[model samples]
Target: IFFRSAMALQLPSELWDIIADSVQSDSLAHVCRRLWDLLGSSRYVKLNCDSHCVTQRVRPLARNVRALQVKVKGPWDPTGAIDALQHAPFLHTLTLSNMAADVTVGSARAMAAIRTAPSLHTLTLNLGRNALGTDGAGALAALKDAGGLRTLSLDLWGCAVGDSGAAALAQLKDAPALRTLTLELWGNAVGN
Candidate 1:
Protein backbone atom coordinates (compact mmCIF):
# COMPACT_ATOMS: atom_id res chain seq x y z
CA ILE A 1 0.00 0.00 0.00
CA PHE A 2 1.07 3.61 -0.50
CA PHE A 3 1.10 4.26 3.25
CA ARG A 4 3.31 1.27 4.05
CA SER A 5 5.70 2.01 1.16
CA ALA A 6 6.04 5.63 2.20
CA MET A 7 6.88 4.63 5.76
CA ALA A 8 9.41 2.09 4.50
CA LEU A 9 11.17 4.71 2.35
CA GLN A 10 11.50 7.12 5.28
CA LEU A 11 10.34 10.20 3.39
CA PRO A 12 11.39 13.73 4.27
CA SER A 13 9.50 15.60 6.96
CA GLU A 14 7.72 17.82 4.41
CA LEU A 15 6.52 14.78 2.52
CA TRP A 16 5.41 13.24 5.78
CA ASP A 17 3.52 16.41 6.62
CA ILE A 18 1.78 16.25 3.26
CA ILE A 19 0.91 12.60 3.78
CA ALA A 20 0.27 12.49 7.52
CA ASP A 21 -2.30 14.37 9.53
CA SER A 22 -1.69 15.53 13.11
CA VAL A 23 -2.29 12.10 14.72
CA GLN A 24 -0.08 10.36 12.18
CA SER A 25 2.53 13.08 12.54
CA ASP A 26 3.09 11.98 16.13
CA SER A 27 3.91 8.46 15.00
CA LEU A 28 6.28 9.64 12.29
CA ALA A 29 8.17 11.86 14.69
CA HIS A 30 8.96 8.83 16.80
CA VAL A 31 10.48 6.98 13.85
CA CYS A 32 13.88 8.62 14.20
CA ARG A 33 15.60 11.55 15.84
CA ARG A 34 15.79 13.47 12.56
CA LEU A 35 12.07 13.12 11.98
CA TRP A 36 11.39 14.05 15.58
CA ASP A 37 13.37 17.26 15.32
CA LEU A 38 11.62 18.18 12.06
CA LEU A 39 8.06 17.36 13.05
CA GLY A 40 7.67 16.88 16.79
CA SER A 41 8.24 20.46 17.82
CA SER A 42 5.44 21.70 15.56
CA ARG A 43 2.86 19.05 16.31
CA TYR A 44 -0.20 19.44 18.49
CA VAL A 45 0.03 17.41 21.71
CA LYS A 46 -2.64 16.03 23.99
CA LEU A 47 -2.28 14.21 27.32
CA ASN A 48 -4.75 12.50 29.54
CA CYS A 49 -4.17 13.83 33.00
CA ASP A 50 -4.95 10.45 34.51
CA SER A 51 -2.19 8.66 32.63
CA HIS A 52 0.69 7.51 34.83
CA CYS A 53 3.24 8.40 32.14
CA VAL A 54 1.84 11.85 31.43
CA THR A 55 4.30 13.73 33.60
CA GLN A 56 7.26 12.29 31.73
CA ARG A 57 5.77 12.89 28.28
CA VAL A 58 4.54 16.40 29.05
CA ARG A 59 7.74 17.81 30.50
CA PRO A 60 9.77 17.16 27.35
CA LEU A 61 7.26 18.42 24.77
CA ALA A 62 5.43 21.02 26.85
CA ARG A 63 7.58 23.87 25.62
CA ASN A 64 7.02 23.07 21.96
CA VAL A 65 3.31 22.27 21.90
CA ARG A 66 1.09 24.93 20.33
CA ALA A 67 -2.26 23.36 21.12
CA LEU A 68 -2.69 21.36 24.33
CA GLN A 69 -5.62 19.53 25.81
CA VAL A 70 -5.66 18.06 29.33
CA LYS A 71 -8.59 15.83 30.08
CA VAL A 72 -9.23 14.15 33.44
CA LYS A 73 -12.00 12.25 35.17
CA GLY A 74 -12.84 10.36 38.39
CA PRO A 75 -11.12 11.13 41.72
CA TRP A 76 -7.75 12.05 40.26
CA ASP A 77 -6.71 15.64 40.95
CA PRO A 78 -5.78 17.67 37.87
CA THR A 79 -3.36 20.05 39.55
CA GLY A 80 -0.32 18.49 37.92
CA ALA A 81 -1.84 18.73 34.46
CA ILE A 82 -2.74 22.38 34.99
CA ASP A 83 0.80 23.06 36.09
CA ALA A 84 2.04 22.06 32.66
CA LEU A 85 0.71 25.36 31.33
CA GLN A 86 3.63 27.16 32.92
CA HIS A 87 6.05 25.62 30.42
CA ALA A 88 3.97 26.09 27.29
CA PRO A 89 4.96 29.55 26.12
CA PHE A 90 3.90 29.00 22.52
CA LEU A 91 0.49 27.65 23.42
CA HIS A 92 -2.33 29.13 21.31
CA THR A 93 -5.29 26.92 22.12
CA LEU A 94 -5.93 25.07 25.41
CA THR A 95 -8.65 22.75 26.57
CA LEU A 96 -9.04 21.53 30.17
CA SER A 97 -12.04 19.30 30.22
CA ASN A 98 -13.96 17.29 32.83
CA MET A 99 -11.84 18.42 35.75
CA ALA A 100 -13.26 18.08 39.25
CA ALA A 101 -12.64 20.56 42.03
CA ASP A 102 -13.75 19.65 45.52
CA VAL A 103 -12.97 23.09 46.91
CA THR A 104 -12.55 26.67 45.78
CA VAL A 105 -8.83 26.56 46.58
CA GLY A 106 -8.19 24.01 43.87
CA SER A 107 -10.27 25.92 41.35
CA ALA A 108 -8.43 29.15 42.15
CA ARG A 109 -5.06 27.48 41.81
CA ALA A 110 -5.99 25.87 38.51
CA MET A 111 -7.17 29.13 36.99
CA ALA A 112 -4.11 30.91 38.30
CA ALA A 113 -1.92 28.43 36.46
CA ILE A 114 -3.89 28.80 33.24
CA ARG A 115 -3.59 32.58 33.47
CA THR A 116 0.15 32.26 33.07
CA ALA A 117 -0.13 31.28 29.40
CA PRO A 118 -0.08 34.72 27.76
CA SER A 119 -0.20 33.38 24.22
CA LEU A 120 -3.50 31.60 24.65
CA HIS A 121 -6.10 32.77 22.14
CA THR A 122 -8.77 30.10 22.57
CA LEU A 123 -9.68 28.34 25.85
CA THR A 124 -12.29 25.76 26.72
CA LEU A 125 -12.90 24.67 30.31
CA ASN A 126 -15.40 21.90 30.82
CA LEU A 127 -16.04 22.00 34.56
CA GLY A 128 -19.39 20.34 34.32
CA ARG A 129 -20.46 18.17 37.32
CA ASN A 130 -17.61 19.55 39.41
CA ALA A 131 -19.68 21.41 42.03
CA LEU A 132 -17.74 24.66 41.70
CA GLY A 133 -19.60 27.17 43.85
CA THR A 134 -19.58 30.97 43.78
CA ASP A 135 -16.09 31.16 45.22
CA GLY A 136 -14.80 28.74 42.63
CA ALA A 137 -16.43 30.91 39.99
CA GLY A 138 -14.55 33.86 41.44
CA ALA A 139 -11.39 31.90 40.80
CA LEU A 140 -12.17 31.93 37.10
CA ALA A 141 -11.88 35.71 37.33
CA ALA A 142 -8.19 35.04 36.89
CA LEU A 143 -8.86 34.65 33.19
CA LYS A 144 -8.73 38.45 32.97
CA ASP A 145 -4.98 37.90 32.68
CA ALA A 146 -5.24 36.10 29.33
CA GLY A 147 -4.47 39.20 27.27
CA GLY A 148 -4.71 37.55 23.86
CA LEU A 149 -7.67 35.26 24.53
CA ARG A 150 -10.21 35.55 21.71
CA THR A 151 -12.72 32.79 22.23
CA LEU A 152 -13.74 31.46 25.68
CA SER A 153 -16.03 28.56 26.44
CA LEU A 154 -16.99 27.40 29.94
CA ASP A 155 -19.22 24.44 30.63
CA LEU A 156 -20.24 24.79 34.27
CA TRP A 157 -23.38 22.78 34.06
CA GLY A 158 -24.51 21.20 37.38
CA CYS A 159 -21.70 22.91 39.24
CA ALA A 160 -23.97 24.83 41.62
CA VAL A 161 -22.97 28.13 39.99
CA GLY A 162 -25.10 31.01 41.27
CA ASP A 163 -25.62 34.69 40.46
CA SER A 164 -22.47 35.85 42.22
CA GLY A 165 -20.43 33.21 40.45
CA ALA A 166 -21.85 34.38 37.16
CA ALA A 167 -20.83 37.91 38.11
CA ALA A 168 -17.30 36.70 38.76
CA LEU A 169 -17.14 35.23 35.27
CA ALA A 170 -18.37 38.56 33.89
CA GLN A 171 -14.93 39.98 34.63
CA LEU A 172 -13.80 38.45 31.34
CA LYS A 173 -15.57 41.20 29.39
CA ASP A 174 -12.42 43.25 29.92
CA ALA A 175 -10.34 40.78 27.87
CA PRO A 176 -9.45 42.82 24.76
CA ALA A 177 -9.27 40.01 22.20
CA LEU A 178 -12.34 38.17 23.43
CA ARG A 179 -15.02 38.08 20.74
CA THR A 180 -16.99 34.90 21.32
CA LEU A 181 -18.17 33.64 24.71
CA THR A 182 -20.07 30.45 25.49
CA LEU A 183 -21.21 29.65 29.05
CA GLU A 184 -23.10 26.45 29.73
CA LEU A 185 -24.77 26.91 33.12
CA TRP A 186 -27.99 25.03 32.54
CA GLY A 187 -28.37 23.28 35.90
CA ASN A 188 -27.05 26.13 38.03
CA ALA A 189 -28.84 28.79 40.05
CA VAL A 190 -28.32 32.06 38.20
CA GLY A 191 -31.03 34.68 38.58
CA ASN A 192 -31.92 37.44 36.11
Candidate 2:
Protein backbone atom coordinates (compact mmCIF):
# COMPACT_ATOMS: atom_id res chain seq x y z
CA ILE A 1 0.00 0.00 0.00
CA PHE A 2 2.70 2.50 1.03
CA PHE A 3 4.91 1.41 -1.84
CA ARG A 4 2.16 2.14 -4.33
CA SER A 5 1.51 5.59 -2.93
CA ALA A 6 5.21 6.41 -2.71
CA MET A 7 5.74 5.33 -6.30
CA ALA A 8 2.84 7.48 -7.48
CA LEU A 9 4.39 10.75 -6.38
CA GLN A 10 6.76 12.35 -8.88
CA LEU A 11 9.90 13.39 -7.00
CA PRO A 12 11.37 16.61 -8.20
CA SER A 13 15.14 16.97 -8.10
CA GLU A 14 14.66 18.98 -4.94
CA LEU A 15 13.17 16.03 -3.09
CA TRP A 16 15.74 13.68 -4.54
CA ASP A 17 18.40 15.99 -3.16
CA ILE A 18 16.88 15.77 0.32
CA ILE A 19 16.65 11.99 0.26
CA ALA A 20 20.03 11.47 -1.37
CA ASP A 21 21.85 13.68 1.08
CA SER A 22 20.30 11.97 4.07
CA VAL A 23 20.68 8.34 3.01
CA GLN A 24 23.84 6.31 2.70
CA SER A 25 25.01 6.13 -0.91
CA ASP A 26 25.55 2.37 -1.15
CA SER A 27 22.35 1.51 0.64
CA LEU A 28 20.28 3.96 -1.35
CA ALA A 29 21.69 2.75 -4.64
CA HIS A 30 20.89 -0.82 -3.70
CA VAL A 31 17.29 -0.01 -2.78
CA CYS A 32 16.04 -0.24 -6.35
CA ARG A 33 16.76 0.82 -9.90
CA ARG A 34 14.26 3.68 -9.72
CA LEU A 35 15.97 5.36 -6.79
CA TRP A 36 19.37 4.86 -8.37
CA ASP A 37 18.15 6.44 -11.58
CA LEU A 38 16.54 9.26 -9.65
CA LEU A 39 19.61 10.16 -7.62
CA GLY A 40 22.12 9.27 -10.29
CA SER A 41 20.69 11.71 -12.77
CA SER A 42 22.55 14.94 -13.57
CA ARG A 43 21.04 16.57 -10.50
CA TYR A 44 23.22 15.05 -7.79
CA VAL A 45 26.35 16.94 -6.83
CA LYS A 46 28.11 13.98 -5.29
CA LEU A 47 27.60 10.43 -6.58
CA ASN A 48 28.79 7.10 -5.23
CA CYS A 49 28.41 4.16 -7.60
CA ASP A 50 30.42 1.39 -9.19
CA SER A 51 32.11 1.36 -12.60
CA HIS A 52 29.22 -0.39 -14.31
CA CYS A 53 26.80 2.26 -13.15
CA VAL A 54 29.11 4.98 -14.45
CA THR A 55 29.42 3.36 -17.87
CA GLN A 56 25.79 2.51 -18.42
CA ARG A 57 23.39 4.66 -16.39
CA VAL A 58 25.45 7.61 -15.15
CA ARG A 59 27.82 8.84 -17.86
CA PRO A 60 25.22 9.90 -20.39
CA LEU A 61 23.70 12.19 -17.79
CA ALA A 62 26.94 13.17 -16.00
CA ARG A 63 27.13 16.76 -17.11
CA ASN A 64 26.29 17.96 -13.60
CA VAL A 65 28.44 15.53 -11.60
CA ARG A 66 30.73 17.58 -9.39
CA ALA A 67 32.16 15.10 -6.89
CA LEU A 68 32.19 11.40 -7.72
CA GLN A 69 33.36 8.55 -5.51
CA VAL A 70 33.87 5.19 -7.23
CA LYS A 71 35.27 1.76 -6.47
CA VAL A 72 37.58 0.06 -8.97
CA LYS A 73 38.39 -3.63 -8.57
CA GLY A 74 41.71 -5.06 -9.73
CA PRO A 75 42.77 -6.77 -12.99
CA TRP A 76 39.35 -7.88 -14.20
CA ASP A 77 37.96 -4.43 -13.55
CA PRO A 78 36.49 -2.70 -16.57
CA THR A 79 38.06 0.46 -17.98
CA GLY A 80 34.86 2.08 -19.20
CA ALA A 81 34.58 4.04 -15.96
CA ILE A 82 37.77 5.89 -16.77
CA ASP A 83 36.48 6.62 -20.27
CA ALA A 84 33.37 8.13 -18.75
CA LEU A 85 35.49 11.00 -17.42
CA GLN A 86 35.48 12.51 -20.88
CA HIS A 87 31.71 12.53 -20.86
CA ALA A 88 31.58 14.46 -17.59
CA PRO A 89 32.93 17.84 -18.61
CA PHE A 90 32.08 19.77 -15.47
CA LEU A 91 33.44 17.34 -12.91
CA HIS A 92 35.23 19.07 -10.06
CA THR A 93 36.21 16.28 -7.68
CA LEU A 94 36.79 12.60 -8.50
CA THR A 95 37.66 9.90 -5.93
CA LEU A 96 38.91 6.48 -7.03
CA SER A 97 39.12 4.38 -3.89
CA ASN A 98 40.87 1.04 -4.17
CA MET A 99 38.80 -1.99 -3.32
CA ALA A 100 41.53 -4.05 -4.97
CA ALA A 101 44.69 -3.43 -6.96
CA ASP A 102 42.50 -1.58 -9.42
CA VAL A 103 44.98 0.56 -11.28
CA THR A 104 46.50 -1.32 -14.16
CA VAL A 105 46.82 -0.47 -17.87
CA GLY A 106 44.06 2.14 -18.07
CA SER A 107 45.07 4.39 -15.17
CA ALA A 108 47.42 6.49 -17.27
CA ARG A 109 44.55 7.50 -19.49
CA ALA A 110 42.44 8.41 -16.49
CA MET A 111 45.28 10.44 -15.01
CA ALA A 112 45.55 12.22 -18.33
CA ALA A 113 41.85 12.85 -18.25
CA ILE A 114 42.36 14.69 -14.95
CA ARG A 115 44.51 17.18 -16.77
CA THR A 116 41.87 17.62 -19.40
CA ALA A 117 38.95 18.29 -17.08
CA PRO A 118 39.31 22.06 -16.87
CA SER A 119 36.88 22.43 -14.00
CA LEU A 120 38.30 19.56 -11.95
CA HIS A 121 39.14 20.75 -8.46
CA THR A 122 40.02 17.68 -6.41
CA LEU A 123 41.25 14.19 -7.40
CA THR A 124 41.75 11.27 -5.00
CA LEU A 125 43.48 8.07 -6.11
CA ASN A 126 43.84 5.55 -3.29
CA LEU A 127 46.25 3.01 -4.76
CA GLY A 128 46.38 0.77 -1.74
CA ARG A 129 46.79 -2.70 -3.23
CA ASN A 130 48.24 -1.98 -6.66
CA ALA A 131 51.91 -2.39 -7.46
CA LEU A 132 52.25 1.10 -9.01
CA GLY A 133 56.03 0.95 -8.65
CA THR A 134 57.89 3.45 -10.79
CA ASP A 135 55.70 2.88 -13.81
CA GLY A 136 52.57 3.73 -11.91
CA ALA A 137 54.24 6.77 -10.49
CA GLY A 138 55.14 7.91 -13.97
CA ALA A 139 51.59 7.47 -15.12
CA LEU A 140 50.30 9.63 -12.27
CA ALA A 141 53.17 12.10 -12.58
CA ALA A 142 51.33 13.61 -15.50
CA LEU A 143 48.91 15.17 -13.04
CA LYS A 144 51.54 17.34 -11.39
CA ASP A 145 51.41 19.79 -14.23
CA ALA A 146 47.68 20.31 -14.02
CA GLY A 147 47.14 23.89 -12.85
CA GLY A 148 43.47 23.90 -12.04
CA LEU A 149 43.54 21.20 -9.39
CA ARG A 150 42.92 22.52 -5.90
CA THR A 151 43.33 19.25 -4.02
CA LEU A 152 45.32 16.17 -5.09
CA SER A 153 45.13 13.15 -2.78
CA LEU A 154 47.04 9.96 -3.54
CA ASP A 155 47.09 7.02 -1.16
CA LEU A 156 49.81 4.60 -2.24
CA TRP A 157 49.62 2.37 0.79
CA GLY A 158 51.54 -0.85 0.08
CA CYS A 159 51.88 0.13 -3.59
CA ALA A 160 55.69 0.21 -3.62
CA VAL A 161 56.21 3.77 -4.75
CA GLY A 162 59.97 4.20 -4.52
CA ASP A 163 62.04 7.35 -4.88
CA SER A 164 60.92 7.89 -8.46
CA GLY A 165 57.27 8.14 -7.47
CA ALA A 166 58.15 10.42 -4.59
CA ALA A 167 60.21 12.52 -6.99
CA ALA A 168 57.27 12.82 -9.32
CA LEU A 169 55.03 14.03 -6.53
CA ALA A 170 57.64 16.52 -5.39
CA GLN A 171 57.34 18.34 -8.69
CA LEU A 172 53.85 19.44 -7.73
CA LYS A 173 55.28 22.13 -5.50
CA ASP A 174 54.82 24.44 -8.44
CA ALA A 175 51.38 23.34 -9.67
CA PRO A 176 49.11 26.37 -9.96
CA ALA A 177 45.90 25.96 -8.02
CA LEU A 178 46.89 23.13 -5.71
CA ARG A 179 45.81 23.90 -2.16
CA THR A 180 45.60 20.61 -0.27
CA LEU A 181 47.77 17.57 -0.87
CA THR A 182 47.01 14.30 0.87
CA LEU A 183 49.63 11.66 0.10
CA GLU A 184 49.94 8.41 2.01
CA LEU A 185 52.93 6.28 1.00
CA TRP A 186 52.78 3.83 3.89
CA GLY A 187 54.33 0.35 3.47
CA ASN A 188 56.13 1.41 0.30
CA ALA A 189 59.82 1.23 -0.71
CA VAL A 190 60.41 4.95 -0.48
CA GLY A 191 63.09 4.66 2.21
CA ASN A 192 64.75 1.59 0.79
Clashes of each: 0, 0
List the candidates' TM-scores in order: 0.75, 0.69
Question: Looking at model 2, which ten-residue stretch has the lowest summed lDDT?
Answer: 72-81
Alpha-carbon local distance difference test for all models: 0.70, 0.66
On TM-score, the candidate that comes out on top is 1
Clashes of 1: 0
Report the error of model 2 at residue 154, Å. Answer: 0.4
**Model 2 per-residue lDDT tens digits across residues 31-53:** 56776666564444344555545
Model 2: lDDT of residue 163: 86
